[model samples]
Target: MRILIVEDNALLAQGLSAMLEALGNEVLGVAGDAESFVTAVLADRPDVAVVDVRLPPSFTDEGVRAALHARELLPGLPVLVLSQYVEDTYARELIADGTGVGYLLKDRVARVDDFLDALHRVAAGGTALDPEVVRQLLATRSDPLTRLSRLSRLTEREREVLALMAQGYGNVEIADRLVVTERAVHKHVGNIFLKLDLPPEDSGDRRVLAVLTHLGAPRRTARDGRDGRG
Candidate 1:
């Protein structure tokens, strides 16, 4: 995979470039500021872009804005934004785009293997958000079940699975965490979708949609969870 690195910190950018290269991906280019970041992406059209949430000139959210702009130009272009802290607003903006994107804390990069795994996931058109980011998101919410009346339909174990899914765990990982077979996880996922009236999707979009629904945002529900006898 060809990757573009957009970070103002020269040392970190160099380190990330080296790490990605060592992991068998080509480094397309490195950009220090917003303008240069957009330029490199548009010119090179790499397979993925690793961006910092803060960039030069103002260092506010230039990196995130640049990544969004690049996505506007090249829709579905996978990009992962790294931030120093858990910012719900940033995560919401990235998730709102509803495409190949990720928001991870900078600390995650130290876990080299996991960081690379997340990068590859986002590059392959899947979502990868840091667990802390997801936790903060849920914690900041006043009522996570406000819009999700279907919550009652899910068994406690299924609710557990959904929580982990919102944290960006894949089936195998969730199974390992829950001490269940992957098949069992698959079953619960399907049932959750059915109960929530969400169409199954392989690209991970539906899972995120379900998470959004679980987080009190109303989405279309196709069926009632109860048999109407209760």
Candidate 2:
């Protein structure tokens, strides 16, 4: 995958670039601030962008703004955002963009193999999120789907599969981890989607859609320059 990095910290950016290159992905360039990030997007247009949540000048959320703008210019462009902090609002907004997205903590990069796996998944038009982000979304009680009557429709095993799906595990991975047949996992996934009244997509990589179901609302957009406040 060809990746463009948007981060202000020089050491971290260099380390990430080196790590990604070592993992066999090409690092197209690094942008320290939002302006350069947008410039790189318009000019170079790498296959994926790995961005920091906070960036130069104001350092509030310039990186995400730049990423959103890049997506505006190039809709559905892949982005994997890394943050030192877990901002639920940021996660929700990014996921609202639909697919080919990831939001992970900076600490996750230390787990090099897993981080590379997630980056590749995002670049290949899939979805990934930090485990904590999944937890936060799952814990949102406002979701009408979480009501006992609706949730009671799922068997315990199916619920387990739903949780794993929210964690960005593909059916094959879920099957391997649960020691079940891939066919069984697929059946459970279909059942879960059906019980939740979600329309089935043939690809089944709709991790963002699954998360939105947990949130019990349609995808939301943040206002100009403001990720919805926590």
TM-score of each: 0.82, 0.85
Residue pairs in steric clash, candidate 2? Answer: none
Tens digits of lDDT, candidate 2, 143-168:
44555566688899987787778657
Error of 2 at 168 (Å): 3.0
Best by TM-score: 2
C-alpha RMSD by candidate, in order:
6.9, 4.2
TM-score of 2: 0.85
**Candidate 1 displacement at residue 179 in angstroms:** 2.2
Cα lDDT, all candidates: 0.79, 0.78
